[model samples]
Every structure is written in structure tokens, then in C-alpha cells.
Target: MLDLTTGAVLWCALTGLLFTGLWLWYDRRDHARLAALRHRATFHCIRCGNLYAAPRAEEPAPCPKCGHENTRLKF
Candidate 1:
């Protein structure tokens, strides 16, 4: 029978809790990073003169209107 009252069980629970906390922290960090990148990116299409916003990862991507390459605005 598996004993839930043993030190092994306690250690396992603690490890699980630690990993869960770490995962949550990293998830929040990634979300913040993505949000910042999204805000930093301002795309402008010279071909169609269309201006839009996109994520940094999607920079140098095609414009939604004319399918032309977009230029990212820098601070």
C-alpha cells in the first residue's frame, strides 16, 4: 500500500508545488515579454501606405492589406 503520510510523500508534494510555482512564474514572464514586444512593434507598409501593429516576431512580415513587406517603427 502507498503511504501518504510518509516523508517521501511530503517531499514529492513539495517538489510538485515548487515546479508548479516555477511554471506559473515563467508563464507570466513570457506573457509580459510578448505584450511588450507587441507594443513595441508598429508596422507600416510603404507599398500600400497602410499602418498597423503586430508582434515583434511577426515583424518584417507581410502587410495585411497588400501583402507587402512592412517596416517596423523604432523608438
Candidate 2:
């Protein structure tokens, strides 16, 4: 019957939509994590000899232990 076929099509469409949404959500989460990792900059503290990381590469990062501001390390 036409009604039975319509129900089957509707079910398939909903299932496809659910899967697509999940895939997009996971992909976006992974990309954000990768971007955060790439943006991190390393810093070394002279007062306490602590090594740390900051969100940006150019900005100076304050040491967590000694509160001394340090510039990002060069290669």
C-alpha cells in the first residue's frame, strides 16, 4: 500500500538524518581539539624552572608556579 511505503521512506530519512548529525558533531569536536593543540605555545619560567604552555604563540605566558611572565621559546 502507499501508506506502508511512505512509512518506510520516512523511517529511512530520519535514520539517515540522525547519523549525519552525529557524524558532523564528532568531526567538529575533533577539529576543535586539533586546533587547540596547534595553537599552544611553550614557555619556560626562570624563577621556578617550570615549563608551561599558553593559548597563543606570540603572547607572553605567566608561570603557574612563580607568576613570572615569559615569552614563547624559539626553536
Q: Which candidate number would show the highest lDDT if scored against the true structure?
A: 2
Cα-based lDDT at residue 49, candidate 1: 84
Estimate candidate 1's RMSD in Å: 5.8
Where is model 2 more than 4 Å wrong at Cα?
1-5, 29-37
Worst 10 residues of 2 by lDDT: 53-62
RMSD to the hidden true structure, all candidates: 5.8, 2.8
- Residue runs of model 1 more than 4 Å from their true location after superposition: 1-5, 39-42, 45-75
Give residue 32's lDDT in candidate 2 (0 to 100).
88
Model 2 scores a C-alpha lDDT of 0.89
Residue 25 in model 1: lDDT: 100
Candidate lDDT (C-alpha), each: 0.83, 0.89
